[model samples]
Target: MAVFQAVRANQEESMRTLGQVKPWCAGILVGTVLAAGSLVPSSGFAQESVSVRAALVKGALPADDPSASAWNSTPASEFPMSPQVHWPNRIQEVTVKSVKVRALHDGQQIAVLLEYEDPSQDPDDAAGLEFMVGDKKAHFAHGQPMAQVQGGPVNIWYWKNKDNNALDMNAQGFGSLKVQDQQDVKAKGVYQNGTWKVVFSRALSTPDVEHDTQIKPGDFINIAFAIWDGKKLESGDLKEKGSQKAVSSWWYFRADPPPDYSAYYYVALAVGLAAGFQFVIIRKLKKGATS
Candidate 1:
C-alpha cells in the first residue's frame, strides 16, 4: 500500500512538471511555425471581402451593346451566359459580401444585399484589386475595403490587361480599366449561377467618411447592389485563329460604405484558437515524454 501511494504521487508530480514544460514547447513551436508561414507567400490578403450592396457594380457595355439583343435573366436551369469571361482566372471568381450604409444626419442604418457569381477557378494565375490613396499610390489587399485615397477625383480601379495588370486610377473612372491578354472576341465572360451572400457595412474613406458624420455602426443602405463584367477585343483585330480574350469585374458599395471591422478579430480568433490550441496540445505530449 505504501508503494502504491508512492507510485501515484510520482505520477502526479510527473504530470505537473510536464504541464509547465508544455507551454514552453508550445510557445516556441507556434512562434516558429508562424514565422515560417509569414515568409511563405500567400494571397495578398487573408480573408477576402464578400459581396456587398452595390452602389455601382458596373462593367463597360460591350462596344456592340449586347444588352440590346435582350436575354432572359430568369433561367429555369442555371445562368444563361456560360463562364464567358475571356480567361476565367483573369476575372477571379470570388463571392462578394454584404454592404451597409448609414445616414449622415441622424445616424440611421440601411441594409442592402449584394450577390455575385464567382466562376473563376484559375488558381495557378490570379487577378488583382487596386485603389488609389493619394499621390503616393498604394495597393489594397485583394479583399480589403475600398476607400478614397486622394482629395479630388479620388478614383480607384484595377487594370485587366497584361501590361496594365497592376491597379491604376484615372479621372474618367473608366480609362484605366482594360482587358488583359486580349484576343478575338468570344462570349467574353459572365458571372453565372453561384452562391449569394451579403454584409452590412459603413463607408470607409469617401469624403463623407473622412468628415465627421452622425452615422454609427450597423447602419445599412436600401438600394445597395453590385454588377461586374469584362470586355474583349474586336474579332478582326486578332491575328491568331483561336486567340483568347480576358475580362475583369469592378465593384462599388452604396449607401455609405462600411469599414472592415471583423477581419482582424476573426482571423486572430481562428488561428489562435484552432491552430494555436492544437500546437499547445502537441507540446504537452512532447514535454511529458521528455520528462
Candidate 2:
C-alpha cells in the first residue's frame, strides 16, 4: 500500500511540475513509465490467443480500398465477455461468445478491425439525443454504477452504419459519456453473411487532446469492447426502460506491442562489460611484454 501510494504521489508531483513546464515532455514521461511496466500490466491474458501484430505499413489503409483486404489475413486476438449488471438493471450475458480483433499500424497511424457475430444489423437509433438524468442533461450515463472513475476514462469508437456514421466518445463511467467534437477516428462497418466487421483507424498520437492515449509502434494499451445486439432490443434503458444489455469484453483486452527494442539500460551495461574485458586483455598483454 505504501509503495502504491508513493508511486501515486510521485506521479502526481511529476505531472504537476512537468505539465506546466513542458507538456510534451510530460506526455513522453508518462508513456515511458507505462511502457516500462511500472504502472500497468504489460502482458497478454493468461489464456492463449493469436498474436495480432500491428505490422508496419507504408501508409494508412483506406476505408473501402481493396488493398486493405490483406489485413483480414492477419491472426486475430479473441476476447470473451462477461454479462454486466447494475443492481436491478441486469444486462444478460452477451449474445456473442468472443470477439476477434486484428490490428495494423504504420508508426504514425493505427487501424483495428473488429469482427463479431450478430444475426441482424442492430444500428443505434439515437445518435444525437441528449442523455438525460432526471430533469437535467447528465454529463455521464445514468444508472451505470461502475462507469465513473477519477483516472480511467475509455475512448470508444462506435459505428452506427453509414447513415449515423461513427461517434467518438469519452466515457468516464456508464452514463457519463461526452462526444468528442474534433474526432480523428474513421470507421467503416460491413454486415454480411450474419457477421459484422468494423474497422477503426486513428492517428497514433493527438498531442492537443488530453483524452486521447498517445500510441507508438511498441506500446501496449488496454482495449475493451461492448456490443449492443440490436435484434435483442439492447438500446439504452433510459430510452428503452433498463432492458438494454451489452456484451462487454472481460475487464481488459490487452493490445501487445510489436517487437520492443527499448532496452537502453541493459544494452549500456553489456557495452560497458565488453569494453572492460578488452581493457583487461590489453593490460595483460602489456604486462607479458614487460616481463
Candidate 3:
C-alpha cells in the first residue's frame, strides 16, 4: 500500500510538470517563428510583396495641382534606400530610409507624389529628384550610377529644384544623359512642415521625343526613385571616389494598375435602396394605422 501511494504521487507530479512545460514549449515555438519571419527581407511598406498599385482619378493631373489631396485616400508603398554601388563594402548611414509614394492616373495622365522627410529642405544644389522609367521588366542593381539592365531600356527623368523647372534626360547606357534645350516635364515642389512634397506628371504618351518614355494606362512598367538630401551633401560621384552621395536611393519598384472603386459604389447603391424601401414600408404602415 505504501509503495502504491508513492507511485501515484510521482505520477501526479510528473503530469503537473508536463503541463507547465507544454506552455513553455509552445511559447518557444511561437518566438522562433516570429524571429524567422523578421529575418526575411521586407521594406515593411504596404503591398510590397505584390506590385504597388496606383489609383485612377478623373480629370487632368497637374504637377502643381493640389489634387494630391485625393492621393491621401490611396494606399502608399514604402521604398527603402541603400548606399550607392561605387562603394560596395561600406554600409551607408542613410537619412532617408523610406519614402512614401502614392500614384494617381487618369487614362491620359499619370502622376506620382513623393513624400519624404528632410529637416533642411535644402533648395541649394543639394536637393534633386531622379526618376527611372522602363517599359519592360528586368533584374539589375539600380544602385550603380547610370545603371542599366542588359535587355531593359530605361528612360530617366532627372530634376533639380535649384535648376530650371524641367527634367534632365538620360537613358540606360553610359553617356546617355541629354539636357534638353526645352523642358517637357512638369514638376512642382513644396517644402512644408519639414517634408518635401513633389509631384511629377506627364501625358501618357509622347512620341518623337528621345528623352520621353511613352506611358499608357494598364501598362506594366518599372519605376525607381532617388532623392538627394542637399544637407547631407549628396550628389552623384562628385568626389571622384565613384560614389554618388545621397540620403537615399530606392530602386526596382513595379507599377500595378490603379485602384478600382467600382465595387464600393455598387455596395453604396444597394444600401441606399434598402434604406429607402424600409422607410417607405414604415410610412405606409403608419398611414394605414391612422386611417
Candidate 4:
C-alpha cells in the first residue's frame, strides 16, 4: 500500500541519517525497526482487538513476586474496572477504577501480575481471574445456570489478601461458586505506596480438564476479572454477595509462541547492502565533481 511504502521510506531516511551520524545509532535504529515490524499483524492488515499478551520466556517465570525484574521486559495491558450493575448487590460506587495486568509464560506455566491503586490496605480485599469455557456464550459476571453448566462453566482463580494461597474455584451463574478439590493456583500480594500488586501463577494444564481451561501456546482464551474492595464493605456473605465488586467484560488472553529471529537477520542484511550501495554512489558523485 502507499501508506506502508511511505512509512518504509521515512524509516529508511531516518536510518541513513543515523548511520551517518554514528554507527551505534544505526544499530539502535535497527533494533527499534525490528521491534516495530514484529508488532504488525500476521494477516498483513490491522484491526482492533483487545487482549492481554503473555510473553514467552526461556526459563522459570516469576511466580509470586510482583517486583521481579522479569516483569520489566513484559508489556502491560490495562483494563478499566467498573461498578457491577447487573446484580442486586452491585457496587454503585467504584472504588477501584482500573487494573494494570502483565503476564509471562515459561512454556510449562504462566504467571500474571495485577497492579491497582488503593488508598486503604484491606487485607480482606480479594481479586481473581475468571475464564469462559467452550464456544458457547454465557453471562460474563458468573456463567451459565447450574443446570445448563454442561453448555459452559466458568473457571475462576481467586485470591484474598489475607490468604497465603489462591483458590481454584468454579461457578455456574449466580450463587454457584464452588472451590475445586485441586488447589493448583498460587498467589502473593503486597501493598506499598497506596497500591496493591498481586501475582498469580499456575501450570498450563491440570488434571481437572473438564472443569479447568487448558491453556496452550498461541491460543486465544476468553478471560474476565473481578476485584472486591473490602474497605468498601464487600464481603463473601450471601446476603451481600452477587455484584458487590468491580468487574470487567470478557477479554482475550494469549500466550505468545517462541519468537523467530530469521526476519531480523534478513532485514539487517538488506540494510547493510543498501548502506554499501549508497556509499559507492556518494563516492562516485564526489569524484565526478573533482574531475
Best by lDDT: 4
For each candidate in turn, the TM-score is 0.20, 0.57, 0.57, 0.69
| Runs of candidate 3 exceeding 4 Å displacement | 1-46, 66-68, 87-91, 125-149, 232-243, 247-291
Model 4: how large is the Cα RMSD against the reference? 11.1
* Residue lDDT tens for model 3, 148-251: 63444345555455652447455444445556565566666777788877777766667634455566556655566666665533554322111343434334
* lDDT tens digits by residue: candidate 1, 1-291: 999999989867865866655645667777978997889876573112322222221232222221222121211111111221332233333232222211121123222222234334221111222233333322222222237753322232222222322222233132333333322111111123542222222233334322112223343311112223232225533211111212223323223244567999997887887776677678666757776
Q: Across residues 75-108, which tens digit of lDDT does each residue of candidate 2 receive?
A: 6777664454543467656565667777767666
Candidate 4 C-alpha error for residue 76, in Å: 0.8
Model 1 Cα RMSD, 1 decimal: 20.2
| Residues 62-114, model 4: lDDT tens digits | 89788889998977888888888976766687678898888999989999998
Model 4 off-target regions past 4 Å? 1-49, 145-151, 232-242, 260-291
Q: Which candidate comes out best when scored by TM-score?
A: 4
RMSD of each: 20.2, 16.1, 14.9, 11.1
State the C-alpha lDDT per candidate: 0.32, 0.55, 0.56, 0.79
Error of 2 at 280 (Å): 15
* Model 2: lDDT to the true structure: 0.55
Q: Please give the lDDT score at residue 98 for candidate 2.
A: 67
